[model samples]
Target: PSSGNKAERFGTASVAVLVRHKPGRAYISPDHPIAQEGAGVVLTCSAKPPGWPVPQYRWFREIETGDIKSSVL
Candidate 1:
């Protein structure tokens, strides 16, 4: 729905947000210094303070040309 649509009858709602929980560094599993050519790879990415509202993972690989290819999940 567009913001222009009125919801006056809906009244107001209270919300609370906490941002004090500092997140720990992220880590990757099955880290390979150099991956084999044409080999299927499966890597798991995770971060500390794991809970609901999980963080999205973006996989990136650097080709020989020093160019990064990224895929979003």
Candidate 2:
């Protein structure tokens, strides 16, 4: 079959596999801090992406006893 006919046949098919290629891993830092823990301390994380779901974020603080305090938002 000619290439044109094959293309037409595929187009007429009921089901098709459409592959969408999208970029990943976007990171940004705002000029102003989102929050302040103590005096002269600030924390922030930012990013922008199209058609992306809400990301899972985690924050960790290391203690003197080699233990980690984790906070997830």
Candidate 3:
């Protein structure tokens, strides 16, 4: 009976558990009226949690034919 209790405790002790977490992506986009054609415009984009390093940016234009043009900064 003592041996059975020891075995149960050993079995429980041998189990291992772990937890992990990863940072999520942070991104921002230009506000509405992003730009106006044939007029002076400023395209602005930024990342949240200020001071993120080397963030990538992309701008898209919607056309009548459902096509998109991508611009990078």
Candidate 4:
């Protein structure tokens, strides 16, 4: 009740984003290797979504000839 102007006829609506469980393939914790190279490993990235928006883990490192590095966690 406060459109004191003279023109107000804009409309737009859309909603249909249903994504249930999507993160279920990211593991690199103490799953195996006991580590013994530099003696400084604490890698832990897990994922197994079964509900809402709760999945955010960015950690990559594939150097040698692949090129894909971004780690600051």
Candidate 5:
């Protein structure tokens, strides 16, 4: 009340937030690389994540045939 000795009020509130994530894709630099005999080559690989918890990567060498390719040690 305007003229009352004291006045008080009650209040309540709520809030929310949402987070989403998606899988990652990987790519390699120098898409197609080749090295000469008695020479060495260096390649870099990376991945992009749409959300938190960054992505990790592993590398494997692939050998190619006339019409097919396979990963080898």
Candidate 6:
């Protein structure tokens, strides 16, 4: 209407989006009952709703003192 033209409509445009998320859970392959020392084990972890910034994973082991000790797996 400001460019020497008539107005066309009385409405505007709208846009929207929605995303759904599921429960996240970690999974371990070859879930063996017992693993020996110096044994090669494959540890796998993942999560749901991995959006925007990616998720980081950290592995830990429980020691005799009942304390969690971080480790690389």
CA lDDT of every candidate: 0.69, 0.53, 0.54, 0.72, 0.65, 0.64
Per-residue lDDT of candidate 1, residues 1-73 (tens digit) = 6878765565678898855554467888867645689987677888788544567777776879998766533
Residue pairs in steric clash, candidate 6? none
Task: Give the Å shift of residue 71 in candidate 2.
Answer: 5.2
TM for every model, in the order presented, reads: 0.49, 0.34, 0.40, 0.29, 0.40, 0.46
Better of 2 and 3 by TM-score: 3
Q: What number of backbone clashes does candidate 5 have, counting pairs of residues 3 or more apart or in separate chains?
A: 0
Model 4, runs deviating above 4 Å: 1-10, 15-30, 50-73
Candidate 3: stretches off by over 4 Å: 1-30, 34-37, 70-73
Top of the candidates by lDDT: 4
Question: How well is each residue in 1-73 modelled by candidate 6, as lDDT tens digits?
Answer: 3788776768788887655555366455556646679996676666554543455777778989998777754
Tens digits of lDDT, candidate 3, 1-73: 3665443333334655544433245544444655566886665665453343445566777778987756533
- Output the number of the TM-score-best candidate: 1
Q: How many backbone clashes does candidate 2 have?
A: 0
Query: How do these models rank on lDDT, best leading?
Result: 4, 1, 5, 6, 3, 2
- Among all windows of ten consecutive residues in candidate 1, which has the lowest summed lDDT? 17-26
- Model 2 TM: 0.34
Whole-model lDDT, candidate 3? 0.54
RMSD of each: 11.0, 8.7, 9.8, 12.0, 7.7, 5.1
lDDT of 4 by residue, 1-73 (tens): 9878788799999999977667766777778857798797787777664345667777677889887766644
- Candidate 6 local lDDT, residue 34: 64
> Which digits, one per residue and each the tens of the lDDT, describe model 2 over residues 32-61?
556656655445544454223445446577
